[model samples]
Target: MSQAKVDNYKKSKANRQKIMKREKIMHRLEMVCIALVCVVFVGWIGYSVYAKIDRAQGTAQETVEFDASAVQNYVSGLTQD
Candidate 1:
């Protein structure tokens, strides 16, 4: 082959190698991003469930402290037709 053709072939081969490296780096970056997103999503779900449980316990405690007479009065009001 002519020298010019050989040089062209070498340049093309080098470009292909560079492109492959870039693609590999991009694939790794994508994987890291996906993992980060998954971790954050799971953390949010856990926090939401924890907050709901905490709020429910607090509300239960508050509601459990009503006076007996007040409960009787309220029950009587509800029973009236």
Candidate 2:
């Protein structure tokens, strides 16, 4: 082959290598981004479930308790008029 043709072939090969390297880097970045998004999604779901459970626990704690003196005082005040 002529010198000019050989030079052109080497240049093209180098360009192909650079393009392949860039593609690999971009693919890794894409995977990392996907993984990050999945992690955030899982964390949000976990937080939502925990929040619901916490609210239910709070509701369960608010049980009614008997208070006799308060009721008697209220009744006496109403009767005074």
Candidate 3:
């Protein structure tokens, strides 16, 4: 082959190799980003489930209105009994 043609072929080969290398690096970065996003999503879901369970545990706590007289009467009844 001619010198110019050989030189061109070698240059093209180098360019192709560079492109492939860059593509591989980009692909690896994409995979890492995807994995990180999945991990964060799972963590958020777990937190949400835990929060719901915690809130549910408090559902049975009854709140009594403040009744000073009733409280005093109960205290007196307890003392007499």
On a 0 to 100 scale, what is the lDDT of residue 78 in model 2? 98
Q: Of the pair 1 and 2, which is ahead by TM-score?
A: 2
Model 2: per-residue Cα lDDT over 1-81, one tens digit each: 999999999998979988899999999999999999999999999999999999999888967879799889999999998
**TM-score top scorer:** 2
Tell me the tens digit of each residue's lDDT in model 1 across 1-81: 999999999998979988899999999999999999999999999999999999999877744455699889889999994
Per-model root-mean-square deviation over C-alphas: 7.3, 6.3, 6.4
Local distance difference test scores for all models: 0.93, 0.95, 0.95
Q: Give the TM-score of candidate 2.
A: 0.60
For model 3, residues 26-74, the per-residue Cα lDDT tens digits are 9999999999999999999999999999899889778888869988999
Order the candidates by TM-score, highest first — what do you get? Answer: 2, 1, 3
RMSD of 3: 6.4
Using TM-score as the measure, name the better of candidate 2 and candidate 3: 2
Candidate 1 wrong stretches, greater than 4 Å: 1-11, 62-81
